[model samples]
Target: MTSGCFFHEPIRLPIDLNEQSDTLKGTDLIRVSKFYKDSKDGRFMSFLHDDARTLYDVFRKGAKESNNGPCLGWREGPNKPYQWLNYNEALLRAKNFGSGLISVGLAAGPHTLVGLYSQNCPEWILTEQACYTYSLVVVPLYDTLGPDACAFIINQAEINVVVCEDEKKCNLLLDKAPRCLRKLIVIKDTRPTTNQRAKNRGVEILRFEDVERLGAQRNHVELPPKVTDLCTICYTSGTTGNPKGVMLTHQNVVAAISAVILQLSEYKPTYKDTMISFLPLAHMLERCCENAMYLVGGSVGFYSGDIKKLSDDMKALKPTVMPAVPRLLNRMYDKVQTELQRSCMKRILFNMALRAKEGEIKKSIVRNNSTWDKLVFRKIQESLGGRLRLMLIGSAPLAGNVLTFARCALGCLVVEGYGQTECSAPVTLTIQGDYIPEHVGPPVACCCVKLVDVPEMEYYAINNQGEVCVRGTNVFVGYYKDLEKTAEVIDEQGWHHTGDVGMWLPNGSLKIIDRKKHTFKLSQGEYIVPEKIENIYIRSQYVAQVFVHGESLKSCVVGIVVPDVDVVKCWASENGIPGTLSVLCNNPEVKRLILDDMLAWGKDAGLKSFEQVKDIYLHPDPFSIQNGLLTPTLKAKRPQLRAYFKPQIEDLYQQLD
Candidate 1:
């Protein structure tokens, strides 16, 4: 039978069930989208909007549907009100800017790559749309990628013209002076010396306004891309070695957009819906979500370059949809918990309301219930602008308790998804009403998922636990200029062998349990998945961040933990132990307390003795992108962390021995 949003309903089951059977048995190993169950190969055949073939078509369709609606918005500065551009106005500018590219000696074609070096801003989207008009592929560069990496991408892509946010970014690029680069277009004013430096480096510097004016004078026609044309080359932020350029085509991105539209069809998005963009636009998660918003004629506002001011931006925008990563959500979760602990009565009342709402959640009903919402959760909801209805979480695993808390407190459909750059950012997503944690729903509409055995890790398809492999229109064509690496990931049958290990739940949802590449065999011949262990340890109230490490020669694992500063401070104050965080990190008593709590948590979760951490070292400072210990996506860079904490890790092992 069909349900709400016909596209979301599974038309046919992969496996047949016997009516008399007690247990639900899904015999089929491969999982395909319900919408395409009748198809021979179950490949994605159409987009939600049939006319929307390329990214440019998506914007044009939105402009036609919501011509006078606000399309893009940006703040003048911190605490400033957002300024906007209507859909028609933005489209005109995009065309003008695209024509400007041609006027400034950039040839329009699929082969031409245009570098976009900027934070999330209206200018960035404009440049992206502008490139779409000329069929030019966009290559994004971010701050986390140092000058050398940026220059490497520039040379590899053979980019001739780059549209930078300001003079500082232009200078950073010019400092590298890559041979393939010829022109630098600064969005803001460029100094005389900056222009002179570019000239000396055998490149021309031009103002963004000059290019737009030139385009206006020329009035060149739009050269829209075909469905098969290359859209963008998103470079993955590698934890080790150089980044790989993932090549996504027009069809790939459009299919991804279709999957989102199909999944959220019940919500019926319109121009009134707004999203505040803060995540780096260079990532596929933000890029794909923003495109989906545009397809629905919705508005988007850019956060101020400063992440510290994101809360202020949220207040101003009052966004209906939020795209988030677990790192940010975890911080929010910590803040609310810490605040609740300040008062006994407040904590009791909050728990009472949370328990009541959680009861309703178990019934598959998610809403801002009148009584609890108005009395207890209203302030919490208002903290995120009071208009949030949906939050899409990806990049990393979110604790189940935090997921439950966010749904109860925020009164939004907090969905957790699993994806990577190779699949246009969403392989699976939790259904709108499913409150289950750990599993990332079923395969998205554009893709079918299957599992392959990893004998080395003892995972097998027969047990429904193996490496997750995806085949779909959403998958990228190949990594740019790296056929050998491409062949390593994509098999002969076109399945992209995602390095992630997954288990198929009874309800058909996929649970990501381990990483194929990140496993290490301990001395006792037992394998350890450090990420899985770390996730368990991080659930401790006193633990903020953790890195679990095990060596081949070691019998047990050790950890480096960064404690929750506020919680730790509160504990210290109550215990009459006075010291700064740095000093307290070295306090043996504090260390012992944290370790005991984490071990207790591990035991409750049924961890084996060898799986539990044998010893731990408390760190005052959190692993951050600035320190090169975490990726831009906030995932720990294991190799970097190991190198940085080598001495501490050795000490932990020595103590354990």
Candidate 2:
């Protein structure tokens, strides 16, 4: 399908990588698929072709078959969807849903119904997979967006129905029900508000339980969804503005899953794979992984609602694999440190223990030291479901120290990967046996990466810090209904300018430097990478989040830090400091402690003379979505943050000795 004025193509998959690049030399890179037919490996494609048939088909056909069925799609009580449906059960559920639409004789049912989602809630998976079987298009919603934004997407995709999991979300749809949504299904036990606010204009209403009941009653044998029909519409995280819903076909989704799984299989088979579901399934990364779990018959578990409950949930689920962003790993590091600081004796012993562990890792000494793991790290492991063999870190750059410690101390293999929403989430992931530091590993299976200069925008560059461009089947088609914006990213050529600046290492791994938009030239003519600096600041125990800015300023760098309140409170009680965390941040003694920590960390990071942070201020508040300081992906809004802190920054720089 052509994306209006952007490009004209039949949406064919590229078997040859080189030819595909030539075809997309000028178009947006997001439009491509993640996989193509493996001409050399008939067995591989045959495996995928079989998987496309049924959930169990792939598991039976895979090189390694699992004893356990994949997935346990669940909810709390009666009237809810099935509590723990395995792969076969889920497939049956999808068939039931797909056939029910046909049995009901709904119009426009020929076209696939894709769900646009954001939350990690399991319903996203159920609806998505069910729609896939019926040849319906499913679009995932970015729950972080406002009402108007959600309405715009619902209208653009021509979505007829939405299954909202919570009351707040149900109200959001209800508010926009008249102009867009034709049907609204609430997931919770509570009915749509009895108050006038709960009533929506001109939309049919049903509880999510009712819909599942309808599916449960339908025949499970009929199949209508074709591989060629569209499977989903995943909207890109609006780094710029309103998100564009990208159209993905069943082939596209399967291709993405195949690419990632093939790459993963070369390292470890998925027979008994256990993974935690934390990242929202609305994201293509999680969706693709979810599909892989079904295909491989792996076990998947959900995290409890709150992050505080995640540790407890992990202990229960015992996930062997986890796909997450860098921020989660960083937080995990903080959790370890906080536990260590519980007591003076604990702190001393932990330090000495960490040193010993470091010595063992460096020496390549493999010890099945049950005593050490059981006594020290097993509790942490138990908190994560106990069986975590590997943790996948992505979405952003993870601190090298965090990666090292999880491996050494936690006994969990933390592997860092890289990708974007546009590229079905991951292009490169670290293999189990071979991993490289400060690199996003090698491209997965059939994907390819190349660095290129923005000839048009090259006038602003200093070195060979070119944009990290990509070409793969996992690339998206184009922005939905915004040809003008789509054309800007994807040229007539297929190369999608990732906007990220990076270089290829000699060993063929990718090292991301920074986003082109984020790289700024310092007063001393040194190009400063804000992300690099911000990452270093966040590595400090006291700082939760940091933003570095040097725009229209002097040689010295300045930062705004969000102190870890709990850590600060603990430190205050010991030091006999007074008042709340916000008050402590401003207190003379507390400020001195923080500054001392910052200065020491700055030196250790080997900052350039001009790049050292001279003036650092702690914010009473965190940079959250509510405050507009964070993107939907939880990335810092550098511009917004700098503007917000302008007054405080100015006062800090005033020459008042």
Candidate 3:
């Protein structure tokens, strides 16, 4: 399943589902073809169906298909191995939980919103399914969310019940939750007070076991949602404003799942296949993808909140498939390559293999070398538990070299896709083996994509760039209560204004160029795309993080760069640059070394003259979620970054002047 010629009406890739993927071992990977013909008509995936109207529908259908197969896996603690729940058992528990909600006086309907505030856990999935089965809107809360943000969403969504992960979370909500919130359901035994004591304060506190017990004694009614009924009020972790709740319906979830599944049809996921869940469940990407995995009759393994434990989890699970952000993929690639660099012969051999892959990709036919597979690649693949076949990369764009190295060295199909929290996960994904150099696949099967001409900076099809827009069943309904904000993005035409700058490849894949709002024109009338430049610059070995900025007063861009520790340390050692990582990061010589290399990488990436970095300041600290520099999806917080770097930016511009 590989080719550059994507039809407006998506046809299946070249792979045959009936036969096992021939790609397991090959002489040379023959790329389907590089010659692409463009079509204006938009295509949706082949797997889409009007069948399931709700998440409950997906679960029930999966239960029927998977039968008694294990559906969910979670650990009791950081040190424990994962345990499983069979589909039939899970379905029964959900039915009992639904009945339990009724005993607790929690009515299931469109009017009631249940807030699920917790980390990823089996209990969380049980409660989430219980909500859908009872037709209640489930609002997910990030465990790391600030108190004020938590309070805002709980009140605005009118949460009827709060499902906390543990006692500490329950106590945090006790003081901050809106007075209207009625019940606190704790997954653990610890609570803010004794159940009777908490009830006297007008909030009933009950253990998870109590709800299940009460429901087990009652008969549960099947309450399914209409396709159009609201499902979740998913809050956006906005970098510059309050979180906006994007309302998703049952149809939206189905469409998103079907579209993603269509792209995945070639690689059938049977019950034997396992998936690891590490992304925050509060995030739409993880939630919808997990549901899709369930529908595919595969099991899901949950990771403890600690990221440091992910490698160990992967080793134990040896999952065939995993969903990842760019950070995770990069880490895996870096870790493996860094270890190889420890040996001179290994590094030389790895480079030779990398060069071979680069040549094969250029020719569109990669010759498979059993020697390379058995020698250089075998150990790395085994580290991931051997059976791994797919790593679905999304959330943000990854460097093309990173994508290539991942596929070649990591021994997995690295499928890069384009999407946002609002799109329910994937708007477009790379066809199984059709890895377009640097492009996200054509618009997904359920989505119709087009570029709306942006004339303000003279950006139009003539220039090969425009604002990317998507319309489909998978698109969200709207912002929960803010129609004004809603109308601004979703037009009367039903197209979602993605606010992303993109251009289509000859083969119809979409190449994201810049963000609509991040484009700033200098006095010279040239547009500067911060993310576009930043992406190119970050590929430099010397750079770890960067925030590029250009003002109307400036003619070129200035950046705040966080140098890579290992790379900088080696450079310091070789060039007689002094000081430890913290000290050297601020050293003038080290800054100059990084700035020069960044410019070189930027130029190599085809950045325009105006987009090149003319001035840069090396920041000692890397931007992180804790400092408000990244969104949960790991995108740069542009507004926050600019504000934090304002003074330094001004000084850089003055120097340029």
Q: What is residue 374's positional error in candidate 2, in angstroms?
A: 3.2
Q: What value does the lDDT take at residue 471 in candidate 2?
A: 60
Q: Rate the local accuracy (lDDT) of all candidates.
A: 0.85, 0.62, 0.75
> 123 in model 3: Cα distance from truth in Å?
1.3
Query: Among these predicted structures, which one has the highest lDDT?
Result: 1
Clashes of each: 0, 44, 11
For model 3, the stretches where C-alpha displacement exceeds 4 angstroms are 1-12, 15-51, 77-81, 191-202, 355-369, 462-464, 573-582
Superposed Cα deviation of residue 378, candidate 3 (Å): 2.1
Error of 1 at 475 (Å): 0.5
In lDDT terms, how accurate is model 3?
Answer: 0.75
Name the regions of candidate 2 deviating beyond 4 angstroms.
1-70, 73-83, 100-122, 192-200, 212-228, 266-269, 342-371, 454-465, 573-576, 653-657
Across 1-657, the per-residue lDDT of candidate 3 in tens digits comes to: 211122122234544322211111132111111111111133333234345547877887777767678898977775577889999898888878877887788787877888998888888899888888888888998755667778889989877688888877877777676877889888888734556555666888877888988899886776877778888888987766778998988778777877767656665455667888988889888887788877767789887668988877777777887888888778878777678768999889888877765554443343233457666777766666666766788888787777887776665556777887677767777766664457887666566666778887566865557888777778898998899989999999888999987876655567887777777888898877788788788877788899888888778888999888888898788988778888996688888888888889877878888888788988878898778788765678888898999999889888888
lDDT of 2 by residue, 1-657 (tens): 000111211112223322222112353221122333342231122135554543323423332444536566443532333245566665565556555544434333335343343366666666666665555667777667666678778877776677667666766666665365666555565454522454436666556656666767865454445555555677765645777777655555666667666655433336577677877887777776766776666767766566766766666665677777766766777777877766888778666766676665554332324456656766666666666655677788776666766766665555677887667677676544332357776566545565666544352223434687666566667667778877777767665678887755444456787677876766666777778777776767788778887754566677787888887888899878778877887887777777678777878989776776777788878888777788777888777887899997777667321
Residue 6 in model 1: lDDT: 27
lDDT of 2: 0.62
Give all TM-scores, in the order shown.
0.93, 0.83, 0.88
